[model samples]
Target: MAFGLVRIALECDKEEENKGVRVLLEELVWRTYCNGKKSGFATRRECEPKE
Candidate 1:
């Protein structure tokens, strides 16, 4: 995720920083929660963001 974010930051235009961060966080949320649950890989609630 870190590497992917870094690549996004570097490859994306400066004007699109907000969009990049939004997309990255959205994807992380899906992977951390939805996908995890679907695969039966529990995402610890304590480690998740309150929001």
Candidate 2:
């Protein structure tokens, strides 16, 4: 679940800095459960964020 959320946030905007990744990860988790089922693994392709 953490991986899925992080992947989506990373895909939203590329963040190389450690802090950026941290912030995005945190936000991902919050927005997800906060909104109820906002985050999830719908498909295999959805799990991978383009580089």
Clashes of each: 0, 0
* Structural similarity to truth (TM-score) of each candidate: 0.13, 0.15
Error of 2 at 6 (Å): 21
After superposition, which runs of candidate 1 have C-alpha atoms over 4 Å from their true positions? 1-21, 25-28, 31-37, 40-51
For candidate 2, give the lDDT of residue 50: 67
Candidate 1 lDDT tens digits, 6-47: 111112223365554444322322222232233322222445
- In the range 1-51, model 2's lDDT, one tens digit per residue, is 344432232133345776444544433322222234356432222355664
Candidate 2: minimum summed lDDT over ten consecutive residues — where?
26-35
Clash pairs of candidate 2? none
Please identify model 2 stretches exceeding 4 Å from their true place. 1-10, 18-20, 28-51
Output the TM-score of candidate 2: 0.15
Collision pairs in model 1: none
Q: State the local distance difference test value for candidate 2.
A: 0.37
lDDT of 1: 0.30
Worst 10 residues of 1 by lDDT: 4-13
Give the root-mean-square deviation of each candidate in angstroms. 12.4, 12.3
